[model samples]
Every structure is written in structure tokens, then in C-alpha cells.
Target: MTKEANAAYDSSWTFIFAWLLLGISLLISGVRDLYDPAASAWTTWLGFISSAVFLLMAVNGMRLRRRRRESAEPAGAAS
Candidate 1:
């Protein structure tokens, strides 16, 4: 990959990883709530919001990766 492509790839993975981390954090929160059984309403709403944000980020990252690959196809085939 050229420098620009490499930078794009890295940024795409960064978004994916950030969302993944949020998901894992939410999972951990769920587990804690399960063990304690004293979770608050705020906690529940926060979890839902986090999930929505993660989904959005994941979809955006996927779109970005798809665009990058599709754009590279012609250049790759020509070479």
C-alpha cells in the first residue's frame, strides 16, 4: 500500500477497534449488573446508546473499507 492507502487502512481499523472496545465495555457492564442485580435505569439507557453508537461506527467503518477497496480495484487490475 502507498502511504495514503496505508494511512486510510489504519484509520479504518482505528474506527473499528474503537467500536469494538465500546462493545466489550458494554459487555463487561452487563456482566457486572448481572452479578450485582442493582443496575440503574441510567445504566440501561447508557448501554443502549453505546450499542447504537457502536453500530453506527461499525457501519461507517465498513463503508469506508468498501470504498477503499473498490477504488483500488482499477489501479490494481491495470498494473
Candidate 2:
């Protein structure tokens, strides 16, 4: 592949993999949380934090993919 295309290809996969791994981590954390005897408030707070973390990663991955796609497009192409 051309260098530009290859760069975008690599970038998209990298972000995707990162986000996916983050998701898996959260899943694992959720399971652990289930077994923990922490106070309800603490568990709720932890869950909120995990959701926020996932949201951040997911947003970043989507943005990276969008940016790479835009960059890959030809300048004069039709909308």
C-alpha cells in the first residue's frame, strides 16, 4: 500500500485495538467488582469511573478513525 494509506491503516487498527482492550479490562473489573464487598457508594463510584474511562477511549478511537479517513480522502472528490 502507499505510505499514506498504510499509515492510516496502521493508525486505525492501533486505536481500535486499544479501545477493545480497554473494554475487556472494564469487563474484568466489573466481574471483580461483583465479588468485592466494598460499600455500595464505593462500588457505584467505581462503576461510574469505569464507564467514563470507556467513553473516553471509545471517543478517541472513533475520532482517530474519522480523522484518518478524512485524511485518506482525495481533496477534490465529490461530497
Candidate 3:
């Protein structure tokens, strides 16, 4: 694959991995909270922050992939 295709593939994989990680982390946090109702608020807040970061990373990766795809199209193509 060309450099642009490789970059797009990387970005897509990163986004998928980030989303998977975020989902797993959230599941663990939920289970932890259920197991211990008195779990520190900080722990919950940290999970929230981590998930947000992962979500942002995934979104940015998707945007990057989309841009790469658009740029790879022929210049004379209709908008």
C-alpha cells in the first residue's frame, strides 16, 4: 500500500482500538462501582476522564482517515 493508504489504515486501527479500550475500561469501572458502593468518587471521575480522552482520540483518528480519503480522490471529481 502507498503511504497515504498506510496512514489511513493506521488511523482506522487506532480508532477501533481506542474505542475497544474505552468500552472495556468503562465496563470495569461499572463493575467496580457495583461491587463497592463506597468506591472513591475520584476513581469514577478518573474513569470518566479516561473514557473522554479515548473518545476524543477515536474521533480525531476518524477525522484524519476521512481527510486522507478525500485528498486521495481525483482532483477533478465533483465536490
**Top-TM-score candidate index:** 3
Reference-based TM-score of each model:
0.47, 0.51, 0.60
Q: Rate the local accuracy (lDDT) of all candidates.
A: 0.67, 0.63, 0.71
Question: Which parts of model 3 have CA positions greater than 4 angstroms off?
Answer: 72-74
Candidate 1 structure quality by residue, lDDT tens digits, 1-79: 8855665666667667657766776776778777775764456667667766666665676677677777878765856
Better by lDDT, candidate 3 or 2: 3
CA lDDT, candidate 3, residue 35: 82
For candidate 3, write residues 1-79 as lDDT tens digits: 9876776677667667666766766777678778885774556576567767766766787787778778878988945
Q: Rank by lDDT, highest first.
A: 3, 1, 2
**Global Cα RMSD, each model:** 4.5, 4.9, 2.8
lDDT tens digits, residue span 2-44, model 2? 7556655665665566566556656666676677745344545
